[model samples]
Target: MKKFALYSLFAMASFSSLAHAESVLSFGVDPTFPPFESKTANGNLVGFDIDLGNAICQHLKMKCVWVETAYDSIIPALDAKKFDAVLSAMSINEKRKAQVDFSDMLYNTPSVLVAKKGSNLQPTVDSLKGKTIGVAQGTTQEAYAKGEWQGKGVDVVSYQNQDFVNQDLISGRVDATLTDSATATAGFLNTPQGKDFAFSGKPLTDTHYLGEGAAIALRKGDADRVKMINSALAQMHKDGTYQMLEKKYFTFDVYNKKP
Candidate 1:
């Protein structure tokens, strides 16, 4: 009887594992945001989030589909059930939490300032005092910049996209721009404009604003979906897969970190 029971338990465990492997889920993001999510010149959708999303799908033995949406509309679209979840590098925060659930954190990059190299202004908040600062609208960087810098009477310029914000800064229409430190480092530093620009100092983050890190956004009450995503993410973390991707895109480790 003991041997029979042991065999039965093993069979049940195997079946459970198989069941977990069969679950399918869909993901959404803005494909134009490079390094995170974007369409390759080859017309293939590729980015950090896309890679990670596919990883989750692989773990779940699920089919993964890409649904492109505007960066600002991602969360709202998720709430509208436009997709099963979001992997667009949306930062988890209180305001966002009220509308959607989140998976285990995938990355935690900090926000940094970018300015023309010849500008006397620094990237620090004080440097922007009374001067204009540009940020992509509907982002955590925008939240922090407007709350901290704009509240100080520093001019806060909100743009629909980072590329445009970068353009305005380059054209001298904006004094400085606030963006993800890693992105500013990656996108800006690699290009001529980035080389010509520099960070004011380091980046800043508080739990209230930056949150613990970035995660997959899901509609509220989707506990099952959230659980599946978190499971896949945790596995990635334990297996060193997330680390590999992080290193591939960013030299610095941004996973499960404070800043």
Candidate 2:
């Protein structure tokens, strides 16, 4: 009789765990990058990525739970099963591919150098040499700056988030910053705090550093979930759901250029 009771408890616990996992789809996001992910004055998480994530969940018939995570720790947290997937504005690069699998490209945008308006700084090693540039830590921008510009007499500074990078730039602590063009425009340039800043030079496109563009990052071997997300995304595009969500935030076609 005691043996039967032990087996019953084990089976019940296992079923409960599976049940909880299927009830909700958790997505990890760092709400510091505006236009993609950011919190409002009331502490509600709202942004382009947040809406898109919810749409993906709706298509899958699952409840969406947003997990607030720091940008630098998102991947490690994902691997620890802290969340089912990461919806942060994480670029799908070669270095990241070794750590986690990615869904199809979510959207493609370019990296740009933001500096004081009329600074006349070009996005090149020689032009930025001996200048202090800030970038969010643990991002492709930081990797590119450190790897390509650090050796060329550039002083690259790493910050925890994009807002901090913008802060330092506004305060004159850094000569410039490297960030996503669309994000810089929507999150900073169009805002009051970023009035004096503008993108310098042209948009940067490096396959190795920037990867194939942003996508939904998942753990390796989560093939089933990946397929579900990709399929839902394709349908969203076909059914005009993507356009509706996109026009709510951006006026231009963010999906025009694919990587």
The numbered model that scores best in lDDT is: 2
RMSD of each: 4.2, 7.6
C-alpha lDDT values of all predictions: 0.78, 0.88
Weakest lDDT window of 10 consecutive positions for candidate 2:
11-20
Q: Estimate each model's TM-score.
A: 0.86, 0.91
Model 1, 151-216: lDDT tens digits are 776989888888888888888888888787777776766788667788765677766776678888
lDDT of 2 by residue, 1-259 (tens): 9999997787555544543569788999999888999999999999989999999888767899999998999999999999999998889888999999999888888899999999999989989988999999888899988988997899999999999998899899999999988899888999988998899998888968976788999999887677677877998999999999889888788885552
Q: Which stretches of candidate 2 lie over 4 Å from their true place?
A: 1-21
lDDT of 2: 0.88
Listed per model in order, the count of residue pairs whose N, CA or C atoms clash below 3 Å is 2, 0
